[model samples]
Target: MGKGGKACDASTQNRAAWLHGVNDLRIQPYPLPPLGPTDVRVRMKAVGICGSDVHYLKTMSCGDYKVKEPMVIGHECAGIIEEVGSEITSLVPGDRVALEPGQGCWRCDRCKEGSYNLCPDMEFFATPPIHGSLADQIVHPGNLCFKLPDNVSLEEGAMCEPLSVGVYGCRRAKVGAETTVLIIGAGPIGLVTLLAARAFGAPRIVVADVDDHRLSVAKTLGADQVVKVSFNKEDVASEVEEIKKAMRKGIDVTLDCAGFEKTVSTAFGATRNGGKVCLIGMGHCNMNVPLTPAASREVDVLGVFRYKNTWPQCIEFISSGKIDVKPLITHRFGFSQEEVVEAFETSARGGNAIKVMFNL
Candidate 1:
């Protein structure tokens, strides 16, 4: 039994989840299990929708990841602790918290090696067969749930999930004071990457995107230069060349936040010899990059899955005022079950929306 209820039973609880095999999601009653001795019950306050969420909503799948059944579709979330397990010590009821969605089997070598993000036995929320935070409440491990500082809002805490990705990408690319970085996308992730890069002391930051509005937001977020690209442009190579020339000797690191063939090509072309290129977006499964040229130029191509060992640093960054995520949240929704579907729908069709947050 937890603080809010007697015990987990076969009884149904009202929850709003996105069921697959259909295009739209709905609110309905679902069953919740009782909290275990190591689990903490959380009353979900805010959940942010990622681009992956939209992909699931529109296509019901992302690459090889598919939804086989009804699943709650929110991984970026923050909440208040409603109940603590018998064995939990560091957290208790009413504590504002941020959730690290992936729970890896601690006994595995990958988990022991501090790369839990690569743990084969991990179960991540919002992933297929693993229901996520779109519900009213959820049970998670106390260790995976981090306590929020007094100054950080539940919305900023919810944003840590995606921001962690940016931090991980920067860490992988080794971005620093001498790095001249080119970020090839102006979406949420790209913008966050820009912020993280700036925080990492990158000397120059260049951002490109098809959307002018998103590019403007990137500029506001601290991008040194913003380039607007069009799919119909006849000479993308020339435009990229001009941008590179304008950026002075070429970029030390190039990140493809827009995972398309064209953007990948631009990323490869934008980097200097012996530089690094990282692909952070999941727009395309197989991209035909300029591998031969990259090999000749000694360009290091890197990939990022989810982040590991980054939550603590991200939390500290936010707490210390190095990263301000408040402006990233352009829209907010209430915790009422009625607004769940609408919130997902709005996020699924992003235009003016940067980050959509739910308040409980």
Candidate 2:
């Protein structure tokens, strides 16, 4: 909408936010990659900083994804299509869309089975060598880019990325009217899971978190009750009981968005026999917890690796007013050198800033 107008010029150079090292991000010009036949070039309009992005900026790695080189940083984004490749017919120039960050190798066994998120050859954005979409322009697969509905703004479209994770988690846990859900953690992901669970018709929802502010936000977003907890090991049992008491029913499904050993253990402890524990957080790679007891009770531990076939439902939830993600976006910044640094810092501080967004 600025320099490129409706379509980016062929010779136009794209400016991207690159993470060179820990706490180091720069706005620099980068050469655009060759667009494949089925790809579409998009001019980014909205980009939200994710927890993984903040982790990488703070520690130079997220889980096993280390920043070996200067990589563009961001995945939750929405943009206007600036150009379409030869074989791309689903989208055209000027289409506002939300991007699905991962593209799997179609030949993989996981892809064939419809769980492409597990594909070993998946080239996901902001994961190591894969460049992200926090730039002036990006070339992405047309199929992975879903056109936003008329009612959804570009910022709302970008929020779909995080919402998809919650939707996918709820779907996997099979939340329904008869189920009593206990969501551990009231961060952005936890709050979205609460909204998703309610949308999926979970009769009772109790959100547990250490922070009262976050818990209040969750309650405002339709959580039936909110319980405050701490990380103390001694508090785990009590917290579990508190969460269950708040729910006022046996926990049918526990979506652990904190992923700490304590949180995961509480999820297991609180869940009813033959219930589910969906671990959606990536707080720790390895955790020591009482898994034997939960498993012996037939309480299943479910893990989420991003999401699959979730954008359409996420968009529908937003467009149909079943979910409201705009309130989650508490902080906004412009796509500038100074603003980018400030925005990341605000997100990293992790107090009032739930979802930090960049208006590119």
Candidate 3:
């Protein structure tokens, strides 16, 4: 960690990567508002490029969230705490932490029930109207930031954001020591899910992906089997058979990290009777799959929104050596206009680049 700075004063210069419009990103000055009693000013260090970030960059929208105004464009971030608010006691200056991006309205029923990720009024960073952390500095709620243990690097700290998705997905699917798991897609989310499933003590895990590089990465990450599939839906049946054979056992759970129609179909076909299929991808918002047969077989489908109450466990996983996310970070960039463009391009093009990060 670097030396901490003072609070946002007249001398504190803040700049952010702002998405002005579709394919339009600019590095410009961002004025900081006064820090509230529970806020902490974080000196941004490492921020990763998520699929949704590139989606918003290229098309100006992701799902229903549209970039109506110039908003900062990053969320998977880790930083050093430079200034703490008056009422804060959990963290202090020089603390390295991973930030949980979404902020829910405390008054919502969802928040009261501990399912704040479902809150309708949630203001997540880099989601539509909310500004993100791809800046030199930003003030955020201290409670949202989880301190990094000594063993975790800043980049690995940033990875806790994606790792949370895997942890939550595994939790939803109920993967455990007795469960045989199959993971569809070998992208970042899929890889993290593989790690989470392994850490959760899944007896056997198989990963399927369309890319050889991704599958190879999965194999190196300790997947029992890595099966390759084509983009064509025609390969679904044969691919599922291959996956079943590779597992050599009934798959109790299947995580469709790639939400294409074929992937979902394969997940249904491969999962054992009375098994579970968890949908963790956003590749397709709507798809027609063999639902009736899956329902007849009692293959329950599960859905995952962002994540809820996962950061602490994610940090514990990284620090405990139960999950190693450093290998998934395949690229890095500095905070420059050219590097920003290159970073997003590498991530959006997505072949070999798994996790693209920025070192501010």
Candidate 4:
């Protein structure tokens, strides 16, 4: 709320939305760390609320990570460089960039193998103990910040963070012009996957979800067909048939954006023999599915963690107009205490809200 008169603090002029505990989010002063030799000081411009951010706010946890202490909550963010370290020349002050949140420990074996996303020692922003990029200013590694193209806005630059997941999933599934795709969840991730698959030259893509509005959004986002699905486990067989009919061709790959028992089973039933079922969503950590028959049919189940080396590609995809993330931004709010609470509540009470943004 304090925007004009000596806001934030006398020493630290940065304010952030922090998650203290369950349903306890507050706007408070956040002190920025000194810039490192290879780091750049960035003034944040646009940040998007993610499902994980909502989870950490409402429940104080997402997956095995718990919010035991206060932490700034936002990862999908874009900012303008305010200052650059002496060691950096690739980026300069006044450059707009999208920040890749995760910084892998270069000493890890996974980093050496170029699979940095799997590094156990990754320091991901807004993830548990790691404070995120919701503040007015942040100091991040210059290498992790990719310069946004002239055609890309700050909001679209923020979209690249979540869009990276879809691109990485498609890469794992090997989507191509001859491949047919079926995405089994019309949430934000599912819709992004549909866009990524299309950009990867998928000839056909079908999307299914329990919500009709999300299905409609998927259809409008270039999905060849959208089917209304059910969450009930017993209805999976019938739902699979419906999904098959919607596709009208055997699914070459199934991206199960909803990691539920029912959704995974439906994917197994709908995909053709030798197809790949890529599990991207983390709806349920422990789900029971029929794996024996799927294995017998040569359907391989692939797993993907966070993305690696995908920020530049996502930026290009947006800059080239191959993927349109503007329609996905359903709501926007300013960086104020009251607006922060409302923005988070709007995201948690999801209906038609696909992506929520914050203009700092």
What Cα-based lDDT does every candidate model obtain? 0.83, 0.90, 0.90, 0.90
| Candidate 1 clashes between residue pairs 3 or more apart in a chain or in different chains | none
Local accuracy of candidate 3 as per-residue lDDT tens digits, 1-360: 110121234333678898998888889877676778998989999999999999999999999888887888899999999999999999999999999999988898899999999999888888877888898998899999999989998999899999999999999988899999999999999999999999999989999998999999999999999998999998888888899999998999999998888899999999999999999997887899999999999999999998999998999888899999999999999999889988999999998999999999
Q: Residue 67's C-alpha lDDT in candidate 2? A: 84
After TM-score superposition, what is the CA distance of residue 93 in candidate 1 from its true location, in Å? 1.4
Alpha-carbon error at 117 in model 3, in Å? 0.4
Q: What clash count goes with each model?
A: 0, 0, 0, 0
lDDT of 4: 0.90
Error (Å) of candidate 3 at residue 76 is 0.5
Please identify which of the two predictions, 1 or 3, would achieve the higher lDDT against the true structure. Answer: 3
Error of 4 at 56 (Å): 0.4
Model 3 steric clash pairs? none
Give each prediction's root-mean-square deviation over alpha carbons. 3.1, 3.7, 3.7, 3.7
Candidate 2's displacement at residue 324, Å, is 0.7
Instruction: Estimate the overall C-alpha local distance difference test score of candidate 1.
Output: 0.83
TM-score of 1: 0.94
